[model samples]
Target: MALPPVLELVAPHDARPPQEHPCATGVLPIRRISVSIVSLVLLALAAGFGGGLLGAWMRATPPAAESTPPAAVEDTQTRIRAAVDRVLPNIVLIVAETATGQSLGSGVVVSQSGNIATAAHVIRGATRIEVVLANGDRRPARLVGEDSPFSDVAVLAVAPQGLRQVAFGASAALRPGDIVLAIGADRGLYGAGGAATMGIISATDRILPRSGVNLEDLLQIDAAINSGDSGGALVNLSGEFVGMITSVIRDEGSERSAVVGVGFAQSSDSLRPVVAELIRAGRYPRPRIGIERPDEQHVEITADVANQRRLPVPNGALIVAPAPNSPAVRAGIVAGDIVLGVNGAKVDFDFPMVNLLKRLPRGSRVDLAVLRGGRTLTVSMTAEDQ
Candidate 1:
């Protein structure tokens, strides 16, 4: 018996044998198959091109975004460095010798005439003052004038030769977050040179009570204030002097603690007038009310007396004693009277009578609202220079 017809599989490209009889008349559709294969090849090529283009676009786009930030950072750093360099020469290390000891501080040259601005407390009670320049030149300095009791500012005079003056900037234009540089001899007492620390203006128009006087219109900063940094220059990014380093507040618990980023600078706007006056005269002209409170205890006693008398305002600047034949006596403000206000502005703990008198010009007429014997009386008076 003949074996059953065996089935054989053939590749698509392989030719079929002519001896085949059944269904050989039907030819394979080669053209359609070739067209489908061509279409698939083109599609694969298009997909490859699209993927390469997407990769190139992604690489190019991210590079620009990544590079821009670093470039800006570098530019800013360069600017700050340049600013520090430009202003460094104007900064001087001050040494004051008194009967007590030698004290080191910092100052900024403000004029070609060898005028230097520094904190008054630095040179307080100084018998002989010397200024060490950036190039290590030591020059003798004389006390020109000072406003230490009220503003803690001072001016010194030296030889005009070999001094670089700093450009002054308006402190009123400064806002919070403005970049500032503090340049001083942080360790100058130990013979270190001038160093710079960077920070931003944390606040403006701040008032701080210091040594029985209120430091008003202060620029609060977050910069580090070292031991010898008082009387140093606080400059803007443009290398212009904006403020003078006055004091630093430290944390106190059991003993003295190192508090970082809490410092105060006297604004240049406030200093300008004081410095001008100091330069013109030997001291800042202060307006006087010719009455004394002596201390806080005395003020409190006067307030208590006012309350007992049922005065309209129970708290104010209480006069412990009035000067004989002075403005207070002329205005009929006796020792028992309490000054309530001046020129419609209330005088209290925040706005004290002393601060008001300081702001008033000499010979300026002011209305003092006084409380006496349970009555509110307004008295007109003229401020006298003290």
Candidate 2:
């Protein structure tokens, strides 16, 4: 075998009388160095070309898709738009002249037969009523009936043809974080026609106070419901009406602001039966109970034991006194019993008895469970309509 390749550095020096060199007989060859240098250059060129090919391959490849599917995003958008379109035509702008000037609100078309549902406050003491259609047609409207002080819904009759009516949804099944579409006039700022806003259900079963009545079963939404958006449709993704946008939270941020988006609606569940009653009788039926509470959710009690007078129980709506002609007194219910439950359900403090009365049918007897001292007693009483 040939010797391994040698690496050598040459040095220049003054030449002494040169000794006879046997290396001349073994002189180094230049061809070997040239071949080595050429091999190294070729190796570098091949490595450079390989690196360039790898970079090109990476650049040509496509990027991976987003984690969220495109179809899901599109579907949500489609549903939201469709819900708005279906409810917008049914949303009517209610204009009334208050003591100040013009007041604005929203209303939903409940009858293609020309009846519209709105907040009672919108038409309170109004001399003229106008129904503005989504097609820009304004027609004269008349207040046929209203359920005030107990409910805020009012029915208006108009002569316009082809008015669309919104389909109602079950408000009892509504849960928080559900998407809802709100459609109404931006106080007519979006022109004579209506505008639509999209949001989610923020809360439910809320109690709100109206000027004329106590509104119950309120729905909280993030939709931009304004002063003029009252009586408008709060529709779900299925395009079914759920509630009416009655009021917006202002100071407490319950109303929609640029910073906080909060809106409240009177649930259609509370208004539907009332509206039907108003339409039929010109007044909504009020359910009556014998007990009165100083505060909501608590019942008052006072009792006598074996001809001995007992102390009065405070902090509850007492059954101490019953109506002279009331159902409780007629059903043989005695004073001094604390009402804890109605119809087998616990009573709430705020409008507790009122809620049970509304739900129970007239002339139907409900079992009221009472707490007397440490024992519980169930009293059966026939409920009455007021």
Candidate 3:
């Protein structure tokens, strides 16, 4: 079987944590992040240390009536500095110990009551998980829950120590040219503290295939996301987190896995509801249609794919198998069947099969337009609960 596109996460192959060493144990004085000169002035202004330059600063500033906000008073460079400082304390390194090896990644604290969000793959097969805060504080984390495999999000819990949480911003309002920061742990091999790099939101609404499912509605950036940067924060200029750094699309032509200014993050707009459900009920009740898409099947039915596969339509989800005794199996959605629509709506790249299923209300009858042997059949079935 052919493999999917290389959307690589912080895997054990690229970097592995020590077998017995706990995260951030006895690490003295982590390296300081280098700040731009503009940022230093912004920091000084915030700390009231710029009082001596008050005349110069006020002369350079616009009238309060015309200013947008505090962020508007400063330039992008200085605002980025202040934003990085505001969120730096919330970034943490995560260590997930599995039977074979360990997965090392970064995480962002989402609540002062100790709710942390990280990449689902970071803790997928973890037997034990530990989090090291940016201040060199180590805390044991308990897996609260995870979003469905279609979205790469997971939540963890720790003792409530008044941790500063990153504020969630509206990712829907972001544009392609907006400035964003990718915050992660340091690269000293120990992976203890926080660091960040600058970039712009290159694009949005991207999709990447992983395992047998597709991670949809992703935010694409040209940020320098690297190994150990998984589950890190992708924050906007105002220090509000808009997405979570998840994976990097590597250069296929290179001999080694190389990041070529392409990275992907799960948008906060899509994951906010999932996070709420997880925190409320310990899990997100993702609609279970029990679909088993054939490995490496293209989500979109292109013109060439339509002609090559000899399908009547151009786009739909191709299901190769339905799980035994599940709703799909009971509904007669069999192998070699292509899902054309759900609830009288077309299923295509814009509104994918997963998105369709996710929109279906639980306990409501789901009418699926199944393409079997080139004949369309409306199969009615209720989706299963979590």
Per-residue CA lDDT of candidate 2, range 200-229, in tens?
888899877432124688999988766688
Candidates 1 and 2, the one with greater TM-score: 1
Q: Can you tell me which runs of candidate 3 are displaced by over 4 Å? A: 1-75, 186-191, 209-212, 255-259, 292-325, 332-352, 369-378
Evaluate residue 112 in candidate 1 and report its C-alpha lDDT on the 0 to 100 scale: 92
Q: Which residue pairs show backbone clashes in model 3? A: none
- Per-candidate alpha-carbon RMSD to the true structure: 17.1, 16.8, 20.8
Output the TM-score of candidate 3: 0.66
The window of 10 residues in a row where model 2 has the poorest summed lDDT is 298-307
Task: Tell me model 2's lDDT, rounded to 2 decimals.
Answer: 0.72
Q: Candidate 2, TM-score vs. the true structure?
A: 0.58
**Model 1 misplaced stretches (Cα beyond 4 Å):** 1-68, 98-102, 252-259, 289-346, 366-381
* Per-residue accuracy of model 1 over 136-250 as CA lDDT, tens digit each: 7899999999875567899999998988888889999999999899998674655545999999999999998752247788999998888888889999988888999988887
Residue 259 alpha-carbon offset, candidate 2, angstroms: 9.4
* Model 1 pairs in collision: none
